[model samples]
Target: MTTPPQPPERYTQLKAVGLLIGGISSFQIGATLAKGLFPLFGPSGMVGLRVCLAALILLTIWRPLPGQLNKKTLMLLLPYGLSIAVMNFCFYIALVRLPLGIVVALEFTGPLTLALTGSRRVLDLCWASFVILGLYLLLRPESAAHGNLHSLDPVGIAAALLSGCGWIVYILTGTRIGRTLPAGLATTLGMSTAGIILLPCLIPTLPLIATHPWQGGAALSVAVLSSAVPYILDMMAMRRLKPRDLGILLSMEPMLGAISGLLFLGENLSSARWVGVLCIVTASAGNVLTSPRNTHH
Candidate 1:
């Protein structure tokens, strides 16, 4: 006979869920802080500080030697780090022109698509349709609140979509390392790789942050909330969650981002935008609720 989950295993799964929630919350908080820094450092400069300082902080903790990783492992890990660096650069740039919530909503498309791509269940398709419709309403040219859809910066929209693609790579590679190493230590190495990729971009921001202590302080905050807290927690959760379920769990991102934008950044969304958020919430939540027991990692 198959054994049922012991209390310990059940507790562990619950902890994983909590970590996922915490990670997502911290990530949005970090994004909000990063948004506020844009004026002082500009997008590229602020991203540079966030990525580089975060690398330094993580490295301080783990102090990984280069020789520890074989050539094959380095090959896999490098892409993950590079994706994170480029994604942050592109995302902050998109933030320059877009509302935080909208950017996050748009970025979800990549993962949502990935999650629903091969599902054979009718219920799954229903949620998939909701995602499609929600995105359409978000992008529709006419708005009930304003009588016209808010104009979007084409470049910003493109960058946000690109950010979604970056996240896919991040998830794939992060899952591999999460399975093989201590989450915290693996993150340090990953952040070091990201730091290397972002170093050239940081050159111009050094003087700006040095002169403006507030900007430097903000960078530190980003490192903690964005990279340290969320990345570590996510790695922990990934160790116990399926990638599809994890993708679905991340669907909460749009709602978290929208609320964060409204409260922290004074950004408002149209009715259609709100609907889009709701659809994603439903689809993602339903994905988790209705998923098979086997889907749970």
Candidate 2:
């Protein structure tokens, strides 16, 4: 009973797919680039620069009105923004101490767990088991020849896990805010609030820009690649792709992070960690394929 897409429509859909992949690549690239600035700016400083610059760019584009900030909206935006701050702050901290791929793989558990929350289905239990096995493999101690898991900083692991918690909050609050406000406006304001919260960290890094102007440019690139481009491309992709299809494509993010880390940062994962990443990736994709159609985007 359903009509197939026309050729032109199919072409557009293909382009959307490409854009989505590109957005994912851009985000990973941005993270790699951000890591390079750690020596000069440190994780907090780099995150502050990236978030504040991204907020400025988004504000310029969306330019949401002051009247939109009603008390009700503010309540939603505050928690959403705080989540962004916490997520990025902890993420960068983890990134400083852990390999980019490993950090991303660990951080992804937040959203994966969120997706599985309240589900009683047997298949969902399988997916949750995959996550647990992956975590066990990733965190368990190993011999030196196999790349000792104990070499990974406990603080870094904790930060990555905490970042996942922040991400859970980000998703919950952002969803509610999206229902009440335009997506662009909500994102802009939330990012702005995060920037304001991160201002203290940005302060110390500002003076360094004069001595290392290139790092400033790199920070801006991080803002554009990580935030603005991905957001814009995702908006376009969502319009053309089914929610499930989009989710499936996005489930490749951890793999993309690993690839980006290897290619750009010269980082390599151990065999056990590689298996851990695969398990998580499989669980993520499986969740997407099996998720109820009526679930919130």
Candidate 3:
């Protein structure tokens, strides 16, 4: 009866919510974990390890055919893989110099901008304004817990901004790639492609890993937490969501980043910083709540 459809609909919504929460939490925690590796392996090296390890993990399961190098797959895969590499690399580099919460908050502008771009709704604009104010507070040096705001390095800021740009590319390409290819197969190949692209940059780190096998294992663990798990969840969630709604859900990332930073990296924030986090959470939540309810699987 009516309960039949209701149960399935309820299940789908629950699954989406679960995936969103799981994906964001796993990604932020893993990001916090990556900070430990900065001293041993540079950001580029870590990015290299993430892709290569994740590629290896996924390949074991999906085992995509090497012979199927169709032109269309090539076109979709390149931008998608490179975008991931750039996004993660820059974010890690920024994390090395900046607090995780601030870096993630600033980097969020890309996906938030994309979500708000064409919306005619006046409230959406209001939410966008909230995000702006949040960014202002976040990036403002005075808001840093450290008494001196100048400690916010420009190189880290620039790298984080570039990471945002990479995220924009990732969302655009990944939305298409996610739908077009089988989930595991697409991720495996795409990660392999990204690893290949990053090979040149990884030479320095290779020696470190060779000297300490633990470094390789550490990177593999990060890959599992950050890339493999969340990626598979993202594909499942995307099947049930529009790219727009999905991007909006990512607004939670900065707040989660802040929490993870505090818990793991001891990156404390002052009252103004707290307000900024509140604003972002509010804006993102409001936007998602007001988004259209109808979704496809």
Candidate 4:
């Protein structure tokens, strides 16, 4: 009888996991840097600067040829760029007003919702229930014993919700366009488009650098850490892992963000908020564990 075929290499699985963790960690650190810079540039200025600098860095690296892509590709990329722009803008707005942990937890809902939307699995319903519990804990009004809810700004909450919507759009667009283009090229062009769209906003703020060099420096740091570094790492990671594995790895971002915010920004959450975090984390982890190993896409 013919010998059986050998099993796949274990090293590949290990390497993929490592890449995913590295990507998520890079993103968390980037968010922490952005939060630190918020006081200087405000949300809009910081996001604009981040996109512009990221576009420059990625363009240098990818050097995607102009006019090479067809109209079909451009049509797909338009919403992708818009989603990225809006996601960054709203996330910064929330970051400026809320604790980092809270903002991240809120944003986690976006991808979680996307994952559960079309699934008919019973386990998916379980995940949905936990997510609902987490949201309730995060958004519920504080009781007298818990003190005031004044720290939770309504406008900031709204902005965070909008950010979640943008993230959903990003996920959908990624599913469509990511397959057709290389990750590096797609990311570079998408960010470049966003930067160009925001150019008008930057014109007014560019003069502030002369009078406020410190603010300019802060903005530069945010651009480097939040946009360029994370984007590059994410592109690298995407090459190693399947989409489901990547999603599972990204679930760790909120926890990493919470830790970074605690260490660097002195941001803290209440006991209830911690519970909410646990709920969301459990839901994500459970989904990943239950998913099949053969499910590549």
Among the numbered candidates, top TM-score falls to: 2
TM-scores of all candidate predictions against the true structure: 0.86, 0.95, 0.87, 0.88
lDDT of each: 0.82, 0.91, 0.81, 0.78
Give the per-residue lDDT of model 2 (tens digit) for 116-221. Answer: 9999999999999999998887877667774643568899999999999999999999999999998889999999999999999999998998889988999999
Model 1 per-residue lDDT at 6: 91
Clashing pairs in 1: none
Clashes of each: 0, 0, 0, 0
Query: Candidate 3 at residue 134, lDDT?
Result: 87
Most accurate candidate by lDDT: 2
Predicted candidate 3, C-alpha RMSD: 2.9
How much is the lDDT of residue 278 in candidate 1? Answer: 83
Model 1, 1-297: lDDT tens per residue? Answer: 977769878788789989999998898889998888888888888788888998888887788776777776777788878888868888998888888888888887766676677899999999899988877766666544546546778888899889988888887887887676666766787778888888888899888877998778878998789888887788789888776667667768899988988988998887778898788778877776776743645
Candidate 4, position 139, lDDT: 78
Candidates in descending TM-score order:
2, 4, 3, 1
